[model samples]
Target: ETRHLTPQERVARGKAARADVPRSSHAEFVPPPKRTDPVEIIERQSATRVPELVPIRYSRMSEAPFRFYRGAASIMAADLAETPRSGFRVQCCGDAHMLNFRLLASPERRLMFDLNDFDETLPGPWEWDVKRLSASLVIAGRANGFDDAERARIVSSTVRSYREAMIRFAGTGNLDVWYAKIDADLLESLLASRLHGTKRGQKNLTRAMAKARTRDSLQAFDKLTETVDGRPRIAADPPLLVPAGDLLPDVERSALERQFRGLVERYGRTLASDRRTLLADYRLADVARKVVGVGSVGTRCWIFLLLGRDDQDPLFLQAKEADVSVLAAHVGTSRYPNQGERVVSGQRLMQATSDIFLGWERVEGIDGKQRDFYVRQLRDWKGIAMPERMRPRDMQAFGQLCGVTLARAHARSGDRIAIAAYLGGGDSFDRALTTFAEAYADQNERDHQALIDAVRAGRLPAEELPAA
Candidate 1:
């Protein structure tokens, strides 16, 4: 709609937005009176999760402050509701933390860096995503032994990258902005230049790209599946991955598979006709309950082994339960009928490319209650950077990369010119976020300690894992 606006006009609008919600106002974080209990928020989230897996979720969340931050997206969402923000809204990855970005394969087999989690995605204030991401960097930097000043500098640099990227995108053609992507080769080359001939950085980038290439469906099959009775089946790793047969009695196994086949058929209806035809060639081989990631642990996640023509040709699909987004109560309920469809819609709009098999369906659970889920390839050359182990310099580069990628994502669905203008060509927004991030990081540590105290009081059960 603002396509008719001149560049200067868009910039003026951004400045006006800043005046309405001053950049300095963003540096504040005060828990409102009658603020919701973080633990109670977690308990509410556990309602529909598998009862046995809930404790595991607690265990993972208790691993470290950073891990706790990962699982505390709902808590942050509630808090973000009370923060100051510009009236501007965009399709946001509501849990836009540093850990959520990953390198994954597009349909064309090329690797790309993008937002990899969308469980809490919804249209909300752009600052919420930036705050969450910046705060996470502060927490992570602290855990890695970085000083407060260093953490602040890193956060500031990241916000600056975001501001500059938005400005650059604003001046580009609409189609060019739409096509913008951080391809693997291009990103590695750019990082090398930024590193100024740092051997460690170049080596790490090369190794990561090589590692990503070896992480396709076939590689996952080798590691996660085994031959049983001359047939390929998912290997059971109790408490983490339990095959369907291990959980269900013999009588119910056939019924479960039948239900799954029907579910797959219904899911197919959501895809394009050609993709549906492609899926028709594959038949289900096995299914297993999979515990994945700190935030997603308790949620219902299943890995399916599908065979095409022969045992060698296999496709693994994951059906992850999609609940109401954490942002829903704060912003507004999604327009989509199914929560799963809401996740899929937001992901497609925000990502430059997506897995071809991505789709959604609604199914009745064993409890006879309906649940919504989105499906996607379980492994398509996916790789994640270990921020915890990254050196200070590498972390700064990584932070800058994440910030630029996030800006691109926001630009796809928002007024880039206005956002760029709001940020301006100055350090004001960056400095404000640095202050906010440091303050929030302190709050995060206190919240983490609260969970420890809860465990001591026997109010919560946690199986503490050895710290990384």
Candidate 2:
């Protein structure tokens, strides 16, 4: 059981694997050809114009992508109709899975946690976020080794809380929505109250809280930097992130710099005037290439670090690569002309207190490639919770918290009355979605395994993702 291969043997095995190109029987994905068919692209986007709700039926069972990525966009679009009975749709994160919610430090030094991931964020039905979040609970539960019946119970509880919270939001005043938050102290206390098994459990949670606090821009700087040849550059976490280079060729870099300047100015306008002043204190420090997330991995990304008078007063802004919204593929044309503009417009509409430095820009690469991106601070104070570690009881508690948070977010962004009316009364809507969530969880697991097989074979490269 403990046989160790010699270094020579390991090299030999690697070479053999490379030569044979091992394939898995279950893994069936043919990476689609680069999206061409401008006529089809135009038609799909044109189709997106219909106001009626689209349905997420079946994905083109391509063997190309081991996991669902852009294809999931249809799901986001389809779920839009599920918005609560009361509210008008708000700009939503578009992928508000429970795992995406996390803790972060606000400039005021308050420790807060909410929706922290936004790769798939967009303006969509407020219900889309809730459905996504609930579905994630079911999927994550299965991944955590829960039985089907248990997974259903978890999804039911999760969506029930989401439904109940929406009702509260529907009746609440705008002021109530604006002031809502679950700060770290209250969160820690709540967790402590719920995890009543033993003193050890209390201690473990307290330790976790402490760890979440130190997750800020300063922390990101240290982790991402190292001295190279007596100079500091971002440590290369290849295929995940790399220090941005100004090396897109001379003429392209010049034009890019000019466009980027315009972007900074436009983005600053998206924030409060006061926040703009704070950003002006720090000049751009460095920019680098960054790859992030399973869905967003291949998109062009840029990370910029800024310095104030001191390193402690730093700002990290990431200009993530933006692509055409999958929603557009079905929904039709956007009121906004540009996709980059659409993204920024959506974020401002959704988030209560958004980054002042939010803006959009486009530039042509030296390779004659055109890219669109929206920029924002890289790391202010950010916190992320490990979803892979939840027990059934913990999931219950977390699900309730997610419900509270989702309602607050949706209430801020969308029309609350229509959604509240749709949700009607009680747990019926919640139960219906819960049933669907359990079914989808099974589908997600099979897809995840497909991805795993692709990785095991030579089909996909191992990107530096957190191992579950």
Candidate 3:
């Protein structure tokens, strides 16, 4: 058993840690010596991905600086390895950029704002996530034509919210802090305050939340599935959504069904007894290869369409391949043999509410290798805040929301009192991070150009997609 300390003692310890590494030290951004080539790092990650679809990953990444940053977690990891730290750690969202923070439905059917991606989650310095979020604000602000002052304010707002939220958690009861979450209503209220009390702002907010509510499994079912010869199956959208029959020519459909059933059973065993019982009512109807988000483009992701009693009641489950987190090389390997377990464990530790059917399993690939994957409900009111659509004020408020959400997640696993003390009750930490964000955004642009240069030089293949 571990000894308990008074809250004051924890705060003192955190303040002491700051003396060893000053709060201002975080402002500096230095690339480590003999840094590995970012393009080469991307190639290494792509080696395990589907061979023909690898080009799509590069193509998506080459779109803009923010998009490039999303896929360049490996590059940022190497750079962050050289930054100063206070040594406190949390289950960091190794790639917690703006786009990764989104809306998802809680078990009670309430929409929540939380970190939605966890392909690269791991226990590491909490600053890594904050820095990535800060840089994302600057990069995305530039895309939106926000001036430097506006960009700096957005970054500062993010850090300020994080600092304040951490202090709030520190003062609260342990259980209270653990149970805390940023729900859609609370988030909308906060965003309204940031909108300067405008009627149109509230109207826009109501409209967006309403749209998010409509993006559940039923909506996805209508858009992604169709009847083929009186049987409903997932449609084929070549290079994006391909059925198992199209993906594996040699394997028979019956054999594929057996393999999937066995793997799903393995996944179900990892869920709670009640959840497994709830899942047992649904039978697998179809499976498809699904290309997902910017960073996760090349990974092996599959969608399973499950039906209960009749076609009207449906459930969609996504099985996404999990590999060693980008932070693993710098922060040490996870104890779990299965990487999917690492992702699922970290997500549970950080999120106040998680998906009902979340679980993990290792399955043999068509290439004869055993790969780890985590499964979850595919569309539980999932929605993203588009950077291109948000005004400067909206982005600032969104930044603060992400900051607060990230702080709550860190507080669950790290010492809240200590972190709050280290940050102090001032603007020093926020200003320092703002400086870092500005510098790093410049670096991201250069790195993005390098990828473009590679494409121009015929070093990498890329294709442009039509804008939405």
Candidate 1, 1-468: lDDT as tens digits: 674788888778888988689988889988778988788888789877888888788888877899999999999999888899887788999999998888899989998999999999999999999999999999989989998778887899889999899989988988998999999877987687667779999898888888988988899899999999999999998888999888876548778899888888899999989999999999999999998888888889988999998999999999999999999999999999899999999999889899999999998987789999999999888888888778778888888888999999999998888888888888988999999898888888888888777777888776754332
- Please give, for residues 219-285, the per-residue lDDT of candidate 2 as tens digits: 8888887666764456776545555453344456445556555556556664667877877777665
Which ranking of candidates, highest lDDT first? 3, 1, 2
What is the C-alpha local distance difference test score of each model?
0.88, 0.58, 0.89
Worst 10 residues of 1 by lDDT: 459-468
What C-alpha lDDT, on a 0 to 100 scale, does residue 143 get in candidate 3?
96
- Put the candidates in TM-score order, highest first: 3, 1, 2
In the predicted model 1, the residue pairs found to clash are none
**Per-prediction TM-score to the true structure, in the order listed:** 0.97, 0.74, 0.97
> How large is the C-alpha RMSD of every model relative to the true structure?
1.5, 16.1, 1.4
Better of 1 and 2 by TM-score: 1
Clashes of each: 0, 38, 0
Off by over 4 Å in 3: 1-3, 466-468
